[model samples]
Target: MSVDLQTVKRVARLARIAVSEEDAERMTGELNAILGFVEQLNEVDVSGVEPMTSVTPMEMKKRQDIVTDGNKAADIVANAPATEENFFLVPKVVE
Candidate 1:
C-alpha cells in the first residue's frame, strides 16, 4: 500500500541502478503514488467487460492454414555445388 525509503533502496540495489540517498527518497513518494493509482484501478467494476485483443472493434486478419512446397525449392538449390532432388548434397564427414 506504500513505499518507504528502505524499500526503494533495496529495489534500486536489486535492479543494479545507482541511486543516491536523495533520489531514493524522491522515488519513495513517486512509487507510492503509482501504487496508489493502481489500487484505485482495482476498485472499478469490470465484470461485464469482455477480454479483447484491441481497444477498437475490428476482426483479426486471417489466412488459410495450408501446407505447400514453397515452389522455390529449385531456386534455393541453384547455387549449390551439388544437389539431388532439389536438396543440397553434402560430403559425408563420418565414416
Candidate 2:
C-alpha cells in the first residue's frame, strides 16, 4: 500500500488538517514508511502468543460495585452559581 502526494492531500483534507504541497509530499513518504513497517510486522509468526494489556503480567485490582450519592448535596449546591429548590437554574430556551 504505497501512498502518493494526492492520496496524502486527500487524507489531510479528511482529517481536517491543512498541508502544503511540500509538507504533503513529506507526509506521503512518512505514511509509506509506516505502512511498510506494518507490512514487516505482519510477516512475523505469533501463533501461541497471548494478547496482553501490559508487557508485565499482573492482576488488576478489584472493587465493590456500589452506587451512592456520598451525602454531599449541600456542598455541591453551595458551589453552583444559581440554584432553585435543589436544581441548577438555567435559561429556558423552549416554550
Candidate 3:
C-alpha cells in the first residue's frame, strides 16, 4: 500500500492538520515507507505464536475486596451546604 500526495493531503484534512505542499510531499514519502515496512511485516509467519501483554513474566499484586468504611452518614452530611435527613439538597433547575 503506497501513499500518494493526494492521499496525504486528504489525511491531513481529516486530521485537521495544516500541511504545505512541500510538507505534504515529505509526508507522502514517509507514509509510503511506513506502509512498505508493514507490508514486509505481513510476510512473516507466526501461526503458533501466542499473543502477550508484556515481554517479562510477573504476577499481578492482588488485594482482598472488603468495605473499610461502615456507617459514616452523619460525617458525610455535615460537610454539605444544604442537607436534609442524610441527603444533600440542591436547587431545582428543571421545571
Candidate 4:
C-alpha cells in the first residue's frame, strides 16, 4: 500500500509523535517499504506447512501447579511501625 504525506501526518498525530515534513516524507517511504515486504510474503505458498512456536523442537519446562504464601508473615510484620494480629495497623481514614 502506498502511504502519502497526509496519511503519514495523520498517523504521526494519532501516535502523538511530532514529525517534520522531511521526517514524515522519510517515514512515508519506510512505511510503504514495510507494506510492500508484507505483500511479498503473502505471495508465498504454505499449503503443507505446520504452525510452530519455535524453529527447533523442544518441550517447555513447567512446574507443578501449587498455591501457597511464602510464610513470612512474622518477618513482614516486624518491619511495620504498628502491627497487630499479624497485620499492619493503620489509622482509620473513612470515619
Highest-TM-score candidate = 3
lDDT of 4 by residue, 1-95 (tens): 67899999999999999999999999999999998878886678999998788988888988878865678889989989999989999999788
How would you encode candidate 1's per-residue C-alpha lDDT over 1-95 as one tens digit per residue? 89889999999999999999999999999999899889987788899887777988888988789865687988999999999999899999899
The local lDDT score (0 to 100) that residue 26 gets in candidate 4 is 96
Q: Report model 3's TM-score to 2 decimal places.
A: 0.46
What's the TM-score of every candidate structure? 0.45, 0.45, 0.46, 0.44
Error of 3 at 38 (Å): 3.8
RMSD (CA, Å), candidate 1 to true, equals 11.8
Prediction 2 global C-alpha lDDT: 0.86
- Checking candidate 4 for backbone clashes, the offending pairs are none
lDDT of 1 at 1: 85
Query: How displaced is residue 90 in candidate 3, in Å?
Result: 29
Tens digits of per-residue lDDT for model 2, 1-95: 78889889998999999999989988988999999878876777989987777988788988788874577777778888999876788899789
lDDT of 3 by residue, 1-95 (tens): 79889999999999999999999999999898889878987777889988788788988888789987779899989989999999999999899
Off by over 4 Å in 2: 44-95
> Model 1, residue 11: what's the lDDT?
95
Model 3 regions more than 4 Å off: 13-16, 61-95
